[model samples]
Target chain A: MFLQSDTPVQLVSSQSSSVLGEETIVLQYEAGMYYELNEMGGFIWSLLQASKGMTVGQIRQKLLDEFEVDAVVCQQELTQFLDDLLREKLIEATAPAP
Target chain B: GASPKKVYKTPRLKTLGSVK
Candidate 1:
């Protein structure tokens, strides 16, 4: 998975995301991919939108504070979810600055 | 530390399609 606790991530410029009601819609024009992120997905997307290049650990802390879940499970699921986004070319993850 | 018990739904992405 591309997401490490210290890995920083930001949304790709080719994509545009908007929130409608409870769901967030991401449109990737270059690839013509339209994604619908709901529930936890929406939350994560919003964070990335607000702050560019936030570390995975920071995002996870926000999730842990807002939601009730075991740390292991949260990490596992968050990693998988981020992997999917990476595979889909919606977000970009980078190593933290030294 | 028992707060209100809750379940977290794993974030999911549903791709509509690639633009033709």
Candidate 2:
């Protein structure tokens, strides 16, 4: 596991707001605290979680089976999400896991 | 060769600093 079980993320959902929006999510990521995702975010969230330490190629195939989203859309959205997560240090990414 | 730089998610006093 990329993250040891002891270093688990603590998710504080959007309880502060009644509606969870894109901008709200962008603002909600708290460092040292993992995010609890909403519906749409959940799909993307799960993909990244399962893809930890795996190649992006593997992530693509798994996403295809898991959601009705197109490969291109999946790639684009997932990429952006991952990029933000990386930038935020919410996840630690390796070099494609060889 | 360089250690990774740490970026502060919120530098403003209001965001996470207001945690109560």
DockQ of predictions, in order shown:
0.64, 0.03
DockQ, 0 to 1 scale, candidate 2: 0.03
Off by over 4 Å in 2: A1-36, A47-52, B1-20
Per-residue lDDT of model 1, residues A7-97, tens digit only: 9998999999888887888999889889899778999998999999999899988888888888999899898888889988899998788
True contacts kept of each: 0.87, 0.00
Clashing pairs in 1: A32-B19
Q: How does the DockQ of candidate 1 come out?
A: 0.64
How do the residues B1-20 of candidate 1 rate in per-residue lDDT, one tens digit apiece? 86764457888998877667
- Candidate 2 lDDT, B1-20, residue by residue in tens: 75443221211111233232
Give me the overall lDDT of model 1.
0.87
**What is the per-residue lDDT of model 2 for residues A20-40, given as tens digits with 9 covering 90 to 100?**
453233334344333334455
